[model samples]
Target: MSRFTELKREVYEANMELHTRNLVIYTWGNVSQIDRDASVIAIKPSGVPYEDLKPEHIVIVDMENTIVEGDMRPSSDTKTHTHLYRHFESIGGVTHTHSSYATAWAQAQMGIPCFGTTHADFAYGEVPCTAVMSDEQIQRDYEEETGVQITDAFAVINPEEVPMVIVAGHAPFTWGSNAAKSVYHAVVLEEMAKMAYLTKTLDPSRAPLKQAIIDKHYMRKHGKNAYYGQ
Candidate 1:
């Protein structure tokens, strides 16, 4: 068996979780896990239905986007995932999804505000939305450019601190220490997007959660002196 066998299985299971959790439908999403030491990533094969997917079906690609293994083509968003793994050195996995409420926020080109503690528990502040891609960027290597657009949009925020972002007119991308966690972040982003949307509908004049409260919730879970989970 290839040494990458286990990693391939992990990536395969992560992709399946997206389907089981209803985070994706009809192959509208992809998940990838990177083996930084090998400089390769195992990702969902392009357009394959989740039910038909298997560990050996996971495509492995290198940093330069060369296929290293597997019989199938990597996800259509391969370049975006490649660019991210190249730049976000600390992240080990990435997931892209058009989950409804989050995609709705991306379509609206609005950042999801930290309107409650549930959001702050994971994200420190607003979940950023990338600026719309320029015509040239959209026309040239669209997938790779989309990745650049996301990295550029995050210039002011720490990717480690905020694990997710919505691309303007596109969808959400999330990353974490590993493939499983990336899917976890995607689920959290979707629920928070739904919550924030309903919140605004109920009280249009509502402001983002107060910074002190944001600090309290965020810190309790993530600060130097954190103590939220056991």
Candidate 2:
């Protein structure tokens, strides 16, 4: 059996969860999980429909994006996933999806402003949107540049605090301590995006949730005094 058997299985299930959650249609999304100690990641194969994917089909690649194992081609976004792993040492898994509402926010090139406590409970503040990719960046390396766009937007924001982002003119990417958590964030982000869109449509003049409330909600779940779960 492969040493990466368990890692591949976990990543495979996470990818399936994206489909199960209705966050992806056809082959529109991918998920990856790193085995830091092994310097490898098991990710979904390119163009494989969720209905047909199996644990053995998961592709394993090294930190430098070289194929480490498996017969299939890793995700076309493999470079972006590798770049993020190289840069964000703290994250263990990453997810990319074209879910409707989050992608709508990305297409509009707008950051998701915090409009309620539900948003604050997860993201500390606005879910940032990356600047549109430049022609040079697109020509250079589209996927790697996508990773650069995300890291650049996070120059001030902590990935641990805000686990999700929307690429301008693209879609959403989320990361977390593991594959399941990353998918959870992806679901949370889509819901937040939907709610924000409706809130704006209902009251275009609605102001952002006040800072005091943002701080309160965020802290209750994430601060040193966090008391959210059992």
Candidate 3:
């Protein structure tokens, strides 16, 4: 198959996965994948339902968020994704999902700490929740400013310990080298949010995961001699 065909298929499948996981309702979520050389990104069109998302319906846009192909408009979150793809050199895919539990945490403006092996398996520390945007900035740039808010939040905190950042009062934005990995992170984030909420309900002051435990768990599967899928 040609590269364009594959890129189109990937964008379709990733959008479908959002509906499959019930992470979105109506048209609340979006997914995008960069070209083989990162020249452009193929994203879901705005306001289109999951049932009707087709490869022909996918919108191709440059890193500047200008449309390069497709007839329909790109997702409203295009600017946010474009900013990430442009600044984060290693990232090739970006996903935004209004998944319930995760968004709930974002609304609370609290980070998801590593409290169990499941959470530790992916991140070494807490999953950060960014600060809510200032009224002036929101009034100025809105979505584009969201990208700036998150990026600055990471700089204020630390990303080596937090791969996922929940946009305060909004949803989760996840990224990886590809769409599949970004979706994987989103799903894991929802599950972890659920677990964290439940644990805190039982004990309001529960502590985070120990450094040794988090390190061991992360290294075992991601490091040597870990027989997970193999």
Candidate 4:
């Protein structure tokens, strides 16, 4: 049996969840999970439809983006995934999607405001949107540069505190302790994005939820004294 059998299975399921949850359509997204000890990641193969995806189709690539196993090509976003794994030491998985509402915010170059407890519960503040990619950066390796944009936006934000980000003029990328959790964050991000849009549409003059409420909601679930789930 392949040493990466379980890893591939988990990543495959996570990628399917993106489709099943309506976070992705056609071949618009990818998900990946790292095996830190092995210095490898199992990720969705490039351009493969989720409906036809199977466990063995999951590609395993190293930190340097070398294919270690699999018959299919890794996601075109493979470099971005590897770059993230290299820079974000604490994160074990990453997911990227072009889900409608989140992509709308990304294309508008606006961050999703923490309008209520739901947003605050997942993200400490407005879900950040990376600065638009410069012409020079785009001229570089575009996929790798995408990772640079994400890390730059995260310079002041803790990945642990804000597990997701939307790339300006692009889409959303979310990370977590594992592949499944990253997909969960992606779903949460999409819902929050939808809610924020409707709220703004309904009240253009409305303000963000106050900092006190944001803190209360976030801390109750994630702070040092957290007691949210049993």
Candidate 5:
């Protein structure tokens, strides 16, 4: 078997989980897992239905977004995945999803505010939104530019602390230490987005989550002082 067979299978399962968890519809999402030692990424193929996807259908690409294995074309968002793998040194997986609630926030060009501890548990604070791409950027290689936009949005935030970002007018993209974790983040992000939206609708005057609570919830689940998850 090819060395990448295992990586491909892992990525395939992650992508399948997106569908299984109802995080995606049709071919609206993709997941990629990076093999840092090999400097390659195994990602979903472009436009393929998740139901019919197989492990071999996963495309393996390098950091430069060059196809290194597999017969199928890499995902349209392949550049975004590659750019993130190159820039976000700590993340080993990337997921792009058009999940409804999260995509609603993205379309509104708003961040998911830290409205409660549930959100703070995963993200230190708000889940940030990227600035809209310039017309020049939109007109040329939009996928690559999307990657740049995501990286630029994280200039002040620690990717390790907040693993998710919503693209202005687009949708959410999440990353983690591996493909499965990235998908997990996507699921949590969607739930948080739903809660935040309901919180606003129910109490428009609700204040953003207090910093002290944010710090406590976030730290308890992350950092050396973390005490969450046994």
Candidate 6:
């Protein structure tokens, strides 16, 4: 039930695209994929720059962040992705990035209130940011605590449907049923965040899309009537 080496190559390429496109800088982001048959994920190793990244650098980890294969350690955010795969039955991939304005919203500890069609199209409404971290959490190592925070962050939102959240004082995390779409959501979230930022600056009280429009847009690309692709 092992994944093909080529699949790992594809994941590595996508990870490189994030840096190449400026969606990430330094050593700040990661992408991972779950292999359903084996209950394992292939993740980019920690702190490797995009140029130096090699497909063989992808490490396979189980649901609990225990490395199963490969020579390097998984991304520092491995536990966060581990928590997601354990909780959301349908989530096959998870991605995290500190893409500018999205991190701005996360740092501000506020949700990205739905602004315009672009935001609505991807998120159905506003992209939610978790409330500020508790004092105990803030006192600890932020990244490990971020894993705990994000797991708790979705308490009020439906993770299966929403598929993304911004951790307070941290950044954005997005997921989908596969690696490619997970990256797609990361890119889309950044665009939506930028759009929402400009909207708030120009008009402070902008509201979420009406429920009717939200429902129509969400359903047309998902659920029983989805028409997005063949």
Top of the candidates by lDDT? 2
TM-score attained by model 2: 0.99
Give candidate 1 regions above 4 Å deviation.
Answer: none
lDDT of 5 by residue, 40-118 (tens): 9999999999989999999999988899999999999999999998899999999999999999999999999999999
Q: Give per-residue CA lDDT, model 4, range 18-121, as digits (tens).
A: 99998898999999999999999999999998889999999999999999999999999999989888889999999999999999999999989999999999
Give lDDT for model 2. 0.96
> How accurate locally is residue 173 in candidate 6, as Cα lDDT from 0 to 100?
93
- lDDT value, candidate 6, whole model: 0.80
Q: Tens digit of lDDT per residue, candidate 1, span 11-37?
A: 999999999999998899999999999
After superposition, candidate 2 runs with Cα above 4 Å error: none
Q: Candidate 5 at 27: error in angstroms?
A: 0.4
Kindly report the root-mean-square deviation of model 6 from the true structure over all alpha carbons. 2.3
TM-score of each: 0.98, 0.99, 0.92, 0.99, 0.98, 0.89
lDDT of model 6, residue 99: 94
The positional error of residue 229 in candidate 4, measured at the CA in angstroms, is 1.5
Write one digit per residue (lDDT tens) for candidate 2, span 78-140. 999988998899999999999999999999999999999999999999999999999999999
RMSD of each: 0.7, 0.6, 2.1, 0.7, 0.7, 2.3
- Lowest summed lDDT window (length 10), candidate 5: 221-230
Question: What TM-score does structure 1 among the candidates reach?
Answer: 0.98
Question: After aligning candidate 2 to the native by TM-score, how far in Å is the CA of 185 from where it should be?
Answer: 0.2
Off by over 4 Å in 6: 1-4, 138-144, 227-230
Model 5 residue pairs with clashes: none
- The CA lDDT at 53 in model 2 is 97
